[model samples]
Target: MSRDTIRADLCIIGAGAAGLVTSAGAAMLNRKVVLFEAREMGGDCLNFGCVPSKAILSAAHAAHTVRAAAKLGVNAGEPKIDFAAVMDHVRKAIADIEPNDSQDRFEGLGVRVIREWAHFTAPDTVESDSVTVKAKRFVIASGTRARIPSIPGLDTLPYLTNETIWQLDALPRHLFILGAGPIGCELGQAFARLGSDVTLVEAGTALGAFEPDHVAVLREALAADGVRLIEGTGVERFSGEAGAITAHLAGGETINASHVLVAAGREPVTDTLGLEAAGIEADARGIVCDDRLRTANRRVYAAGDIAGKGALTHLAGWHGSVILRNLYFGVPTRQSSNPIPACVYTSPGLAQIGLTEAKAREQYGGKVSVTSWPFHDNDRAIAEGDTAGGVKLVLGKGGKLLGVHVAGARSDDIAALAAITMAKGGTVRDLTGPVLAYPTRGEAIKRAAGKHFEPVVFGPFAKAWAGLLSALH
Candidate 1:
């Protein structure tokens, strides 16, 4: 293969969420940029992950809503899902978002696009099949792929990962999913709503990273939706033929299903990147980087899943901003210190920001106070008949908001408000000051914050003071 050497101000590997944003920003700033991607232009997010998954979830949610309307005086009968049409919807969503991340788009933005796999050849250089990039700075955004566990018969059995799950022509009669993380839970609930009998198996607790109370809410919802939740158990092995598969559990139980979807986890795509050639240090997790997203080689930075910071699309975009500011304006910002919000896009979406309750209790001991406001108490929730979950806020001394976990309708949107408040070092008072429109889910946030100050506002001393003031009046 003939290799042509090229030079640029920045060379970004992988055109996923992080790489695309970083490349565009750098190019718009008049810096010469080169972007390399071996596969799809938009990386895993647009091609196989978030875009398709969310599209499927939307369809499933529609199906579920139709069935749920009976409780609200309207009777929308059971939904008949055409699995092929649903997959088409997922594809159409990807097609709609594809142009924004295409090679032509980036090229028009003054970026030199290289469609090839890239690996480091030297401390300051990386090369692909037809081109070599020697840049002043390099950004690695290789992302990750589904981590397939070593189940005894997994290799021999026909299984689906996120990459291949969308390709199904017909819905499985019974869908068995491994892992209970965000992806597993989201897809499990989606398939169940789409009329598939879903059984989700997790080696550990379901939604283990989320607040336990919030997880309980989602667990109940998933069960109500016909998704069988199997927690605290691992798959001992697999058996059965192509049409029928059997997962033997550790506790001597077996689950038979038509299809098995593996959502266990993801592994970073760094094995073939030749990090050793460039002295870039990485572990099993991903490339090692400082809070500033810089690798051992100061000229190189890692972003997105490959950075080991967080495997979230939003976080990947944030990494792009951090890289641009540091490279162009000489500003040092730590990605870790920034308030990162995460949400599981299920019905009554689970969203969280900053420290969890357990983390807060561990860090501050008894100095922290945990306050909650149930959706049942929210007037909007009562009216909508969607009052399944609530909000939990962890507050420190002087009402400093340590964290916020919400599980209810539109919790993702509510968490965004909390993220902004936390970013600005605001407290519960700020949340309560805003007079949110009545009969809206947003009111739940304000109500939750109000609970934090209930003791002080309705205390005996305040009551006495109010009585005296009334007498004087």
Candidate 2:
């Protein structure tokens, strides 16, 4: 090792969501924090993931709205999408949000930001090319990268991953995507609406982690948007070049596409971190951490995608808070106890919190109750002419909220309300009491909650009582 060395109370590796949060929080607590990044400062979320994808989705939604306006009595002309300008918008979003996660920002916050690759050389020490860092604790926030599956001939063809998809100079003629998870579904619908013939191929059920009914609604929405969704199939092989690519499916179907975008999955970036030297246990998934986010070595902790909790940006930030609580304030907190919310930003959107209906059924069996309300019943949804999906709430005995699954316009916003309710140990009854404004999508929540009491509200006894009251009146 070189003579150059740095010392800090906290040393964070990888400058993504988790690393950035931990660095900023620790430094603010008046602790000496050193942050390291081998790639972009903002990592996957800011650079290649959420920000860019959402920007493209926004543009796609605008195009879709113009075409959909006919039903609303608006005669908007056909959208002329400038592909190059769309890419520029994506880049501008990244640029606008870049400075908040830049090296100068952290440096200004009194953090020593190191722009280099770091690896564990000892239990308490990490080394890079120019400097060695000895810290009281280490946090491995090295996020994930796009996972390329081992399809035959895949390596020989040019394909798009999240990292490189935003760089397209021209719109694809026919876009073929693999996987029907959030990434694949979101981008597939976006490109399809933007005038590309899109085919989304998924090996398992689409949105496998969500409820079947919710997935069905999104499937219909995507189909209506001109995306050819091929589920229960995997890519067996790839051939041809960038302009004229082909995918052979496991079921023997062949797809001819102008471009291939692999949204299959993501793998943790832990291979180069030299974890064995630090006695930190990590596998193909990510670092093996306890509920407190501590690795096998007590002095080392992990967060974000490398934590193996979930590859979500918000969860990564939550992990950072857990680290800060446990390390800085001596507060014991478990990462699993917190409610995790996820969303797929399609036109109708799909969002979920806590357990899915399938998981609730599997665990509680007869003890769970599922209530639902359709978007068509909502005034705003009908008025907006976007009534395609609905909301489902999974409750345990006594109406205790076990989960919330929403698929429709503003589903993410509705799921956020459910998250707060669940976080406070509230129940379906709790949601029913709130008098939300009329003619809004939010009223769907109260309507969904009212279903849990429908038996009491509409039973024979209630009808008899209503007859008595009518006679008295």
Candidate 3:
């Protein structure tokens, strides 16, 4: 058998959002671009992570709304859930978006798309099952996958990860989750709402990296939604028998579950790609990239979840664009650590952008101002009967908005707006002067901004305001 050889200006591995975007941009520049993918083109986000999860969450939300119809003076019974149909809806959502990332679409854009597992044969060359590709510059956007832990008897038990959890034909009678990160919390709540007994066990605290206050709010909501949240606990091991998996905790507690999900963390897909051939550096954390998303090897670059920074799809898109700018134009675009928003898609989705109160105080020596407003006080929230969440704004000494975190309805969309303001170095005054639409959740932003009014109004203008008011009277 003869090995095939192909050459291109740029070779990109992994046809997820990052690889696809990079391929499209390079092809537009008339650069000979070749992209490789081992499996699906859209990667985990479209196939397993964001798209499918959101679709499932939406169905769960509708079911929840139907159950709550009694409060609105409408007689509605409990939602009848057909698990297979729900899974179909999730698959349909992915299929609907698949064509945009199909191989034909990239081919139309002048990109050579190859479906194969590519490993580096040299710094400039990669060999797959069928062909060998060589290029001047290479991008590894292989993305990350669920970090499967080494638990005794785990291999014998059937388990779920974000990747295969969506393919479930029927909802498990009891689901035991082993992480309290964004994915665990979101999926746990959705399953609980859909009538599954969900137990979310966190090794540390729930939403461990978030501000303590935000965690408190989210924890309360999850508890109210009938999720058995176990924080600051560790899973000692797992035992599988009689078609069920039993998770033994460190404290001698055991949770017998029909299914076990390992949402602990994610490991970057850099290990199998043979980075040494390119002299690139990576570890369990991820590929070590500089500010420009360039690896130790100057000719190579990395982005998206593989970069191991912000793992959101939006950030992946942003990083992809930056990689192209740095690669093509020689314009060094640095990835910003600030103003990245992360959203948890639960009943009341938690959207967090910028810095948390703890982080801001740590960085600024306590010269930070924090203010918030609950959705219960907002008109839209009251009408919608989802007044369980709120928004928090963090600011530094110079009135620089450090972060805007929201946990409520449509928070993902709202957080994008907050990201824009924080990215531009916006301040409370910027939020104050704006007349937000009436009867909307966004009004909470303005309401939170109003907290700054008391100090300003009472400090220097207190006597002037009293005199003016007395004269008018």
Cα-based TM-score, every candidate: 0.98, 0.97, 0.95
lDDT per residue for candidate 3 within 344-395, as digits (tens), equals: 8886777888788888888997689899898989999999877877888888
| lDDT per residue (tens digit) for residues 318-435 in model 2 | 9999999999899899998788999999978889998887799899999998899999999999888889889999999999899998989999998888899888889999999888
Cα RMSD for candidates in order: 1.0, 1.7, 2.0
lDDT of 2: 0.92
Best by TM-score: 1
Evaluate model 2: give its TM-score. Answer: 0.97
Candidate 1 has its poorest 10 consecutive residues by lDDT at 329-338
What digit string (tens of lDDT, one per residue) describes model 1 on residues 352-386? 99888999999999999988889998898899898
User: Using alpha carbons, what is the TM-score of model 3?
Assistant: 0.95
* Candidate closer to the true structure by lDDT (higher is better), 1 or 3: 1
